[model samples]
Target chain A: MQSARADAAARLADMGLPGRRDEYWRWTNPAPFMAEAVPEAGAFRADTPIFADMPKVRLVFTDGVFDAAASDDPRLAGVEIARLADAPQWAGAFYGSLEASGQAPVRRPFAALNTARASDGVMLRVTGRAARPVHISYRQSSDTSEAILHHCVKLEEGAELTLLETGTAAARANLVLEVDVGAGARFHHIRPQGRSHGHRVYSAIFARISAGALFKSFTLSMNGRLTRNEAMIEIVGDNALAHIAGAALGDGADGDFHHDDTVFITHGAEGGESRQVFKKVLRHGATGIFQGKILVQPGAQKTDGYQISQALMLDDLCQFLAKPELEIYADDVKCSHGSTTGAIDETALFYLRSRGVPREEAVSLLVLSFLADAIAEIDDEAIAAEILARLQDWLARHRG
Target chain B: MLEIKNLHVKLQEEEKVILKGVNLHVGAGQVHAIMGPNGSGKSTLSYVLSGREGYEVTAGSATLLGQDLLALDPEERAAAGLFLAFQYPVEIPGVGNMVFLRTALNAQRKARNEPEVSAGEFLKLVREKAKTLKIDAEMLKRPVNVGFSGGEKKRNEILQMAVLEPRMCVLDETDSGLDVDAMKLVADGVNALRDAGRSFLVITHYQRLLDHIAPDVVHIMADGRIIRTGGPDLALEVEKNGYADLLAGVL
Candidate 1:
């Protein structure tokens, strides 16, 4: 007899890949995406350790299983971090829905695969409130070759957590993170997807914000061969707010990056607001794509949702495709989406150059200014400064 | 301090010349006012002298402090102690006035190999200058020339010149958009920065501003060249009888 997970995986295999004809995957074609075969079993390493400076609570997962002895973070009190085998009830409720809906209608074949093989991922629950949020770092290096999927965080009522996740790998890796924010809870998730020359990563973050909860997400994508990040967020509660911001810089041949953000402001959720801003700069024949949709259901009045996507192409060979869509079913709601693609301002460039600033420095300053609004949204000034420095470094190396 | 020997220039890509064989000389301890009717190339002369770029110097030579002025870039000319107070200043968004002023000042200083001034010291220096100019403290924190009134923008140009402290300053009708009170404030700020080692070329369409700054020499320009030269009284004569008599006398 086949297990439920096995049955779902077989069903996904029968469906095959999702193609361009699929409505959701219309802009970004994930059917032809290259995927590594799933291994039968894998184990975590106890000797090799990472994230030494953080609050000491680091969970290392190899393939899809947790390493108990290697994971030691005492501050994880008032919260539970367990595997599917340990918490079958919680897993049944969460994974059961995902398993039942695995083959529903998602356009991406990878997302179906994720749901089918959704074992070994962590389920973090902060009941009532927690002392400090756990910091989960997904470190996928060359040693662990199997596809990595292990971090899933959820904050219950009145809970608060700050998650810093990094996708550090030299080989092909697929990471999926699912976060559920309960009523009045706050979640700050930061993902810095570092890139390798020959690596390809597809990461999907599925989050649902309950009533009065806040979700703030920041993503920085750099040095990826072909990286696609998707965030499907649902505002299931009334008066909820979500702010999502991301910045990406692509360089190198065949360096393709794609981002698809689908937000659903459900009906009866009055005073719900969603704001998303994504900025990208393509260089050296690199390609970037952004498809954002804000769906306001019926009775979702007073829902203010705004999205803007801007790109700066350094070379004529560079390409960018930006599609911003707004579907409003409710009246008396303010929703707008705008997209623009152009090169740097030559007049402003000349103005700066006439002031004795070198052409390169002038362009860099302007680019920094262009990305400043996104960077400024970060509450931590130190983190903001670090991101800005990294952005400047990338410009200095690739732009010159 | 500045000399132009038969300088000829044409506005961007134009076949016709604007400043044709215009000669002007200004030494330290001197203020030269060039009054001309419309279409006399007064603004073109300022743009060409400051190396604003896009102008074709068909034939001419301009030297500042014995260095080829036209050969240098705009910032280079500025670092060489040449300043042009524009008739219409540009509004640079997202750049605070103090930040822009400090960056420009530090860039010039760095070019000279001088140590950069501390932020505290720079603020102190700017605050003192702003008080004398009657500029509000809050204005320094706002973006440069963004949403500034006409008089306020003109005052900002003068404030910049004062901070830059160039050896020779060219005022291109800085008095055009200013009221009487604002005009007096602008003139007072320029006069306070005046020194024996610095020269100024004030370009105006009326003798109203001359009554305040009191130019040392006034030259009447017609068509594209200077037709007559005289003391400060020439501005009054032109104001009383208009450029009609002045052009007739020159012809």
Candidate 2:
């Protein structure tokens, strides 16, 4: 473990920090993250816990440091679990493995930095269906704390597991999650970051899926000063499925709010299906960016790839930027990509208002309707309900 | 139920006059038909009464049950019991028809300081109303007016009217794109909603629609003014001799 850490540190030193001159960081500036200093953010308060109704194994982290007193034992999850620092020999091959594979053709310097510096995280290996979900709660109570977390998960053949990451991590957070899905296994990830006004967040997910495996991930984010999310997925075996979705609402009424999602998906085997759906509602000078690509290598036949990113701007002050790319080396594949930025339909608004809905309420309905496509990707009914409620709550307080 | 006095309006962008000193009155329990040619300001009147934007009411007053209608927003006017069945119903892509109806009904109820209808009650009410218009369950679950045919859209407008139960309703060319069977079905739906306290302003280009809706009074509008007003016979004369001849007689 220590040897892998030293290798990652040396690799980070060679690559250095990201800058605005880089193609990936042009739309979103990297100045706030390049220095050795951690930026300041206001602390957040929540009235209720997310996913409060579900049975789960909970791990609590306050300002990047794990709190044993506030968390449930990982053994209660009915899965093999250990702290990342104290992980057994099985974790050595999977810790930085997928993240290193994702570095080629693209370099996420922050992810490498996280691998080198993260002090504490969780390692879970699921051999059978887990009795309960593993919920990682990043609860923050500090205004200037910086957190670096590196978590890894491995699912054995015919295994099933669900992992959830929620709450505001810290004033500044760099998180990296590496996952390996064995044959005939399934993995689900649902993360809804808590809103903090001045926070800066950078997170990445790297996964390798085997044949006959299923992987689904959804994220919901609303309030943050700056956020960048990157996802790199590889379907190395036939008959695998991968779905990634995100919904973000940017409110720049205060000062600055920008969110970016950059995704890359590769198909290496036949009969693989992948989809990417991302939607954002921006208002009052906020900005949203999307850079997504799908790659089908030789002999990867019968691959179905779909990507859509749309932004509904409430006013003229907001803007959206997108770059959608599709690369194919096989002739027997179907792939489509689309991106659009538009304002609320005036005619539709008048129709709603004429039917007795107030302007604010009508606007909220339309915004939610815009996000419905992305939210529909979640397969769990209970989880989708909780997300819908939070989305409604956001729209109510955002009415201006 | 609705009174318009010296209502003058113009296109906000072009500054061109559309409604020139239009005056009309619709009494409770009565059905009035306004017949006119294209660009005669017939549609503008409905839009102005419903408080749609881009129309400047330079002068005039529209009162609903003695309350000023022009002073309120469009939604407020709706809460005040005014409804307009659009000439071309707008299509909302992601809002289900059932959800839209319930939201509209509940919103009006809440605005009027009444208790909201529960989901079960709303569902029962909508199914009852939707069945009368020949709208099936699939149509109710689909997005509002999205992928619906022309006749389906018009019927959806009537379904909304029935559910909202407004006091004064304006049918703006609701018979424009309907076949005979669809027209009769829609006419029956409108007829079912008529009562002693509800009034209707039926604006159409042909008298054939009036034959089914059976207006008590008919008015001929030309160049943004009501040129003639009489009993139902006036619509027949206009339909027979055409608006050019009627304008000649009035001028």
| Highest TM-score against the true fold, candidate | 2
lDDT of 1 by residue, B9-117 (tens): 8867668888889998898879999999998988888888877767899887999989999898777787788888878776666556887788778877877778887
TM-score of each: 0.81, 0.94
Q: Please, what is the whole-model Cα lDDT of each candidate in the order they appear?
A: 0.72, 0.90
State the weakest 10-residue window (summed lDDT) of model 1 chain A.
A38-47
Q: Which ten residues in a row have the lowest lDDT in candidate 1 chain B?
A: B87-96
What lDDT tens digits, residue by residue, belong to model 2 across residues B1-251?
89999999999898799888888899999999999999899999999999899999999999999999999999999999999999899887667788888889999999999999999999998899999888898999998898999889988999999999999999999999899888888899999999999999999999989888999899988888898899999999887888898888766
Give model 2's TM-score for chain A to 2 decimal places. Answer: 0.98
Fraction of native Cα contacts reproduced by each candidate:
0.14, 0.67
lDDT of 2: 0.90
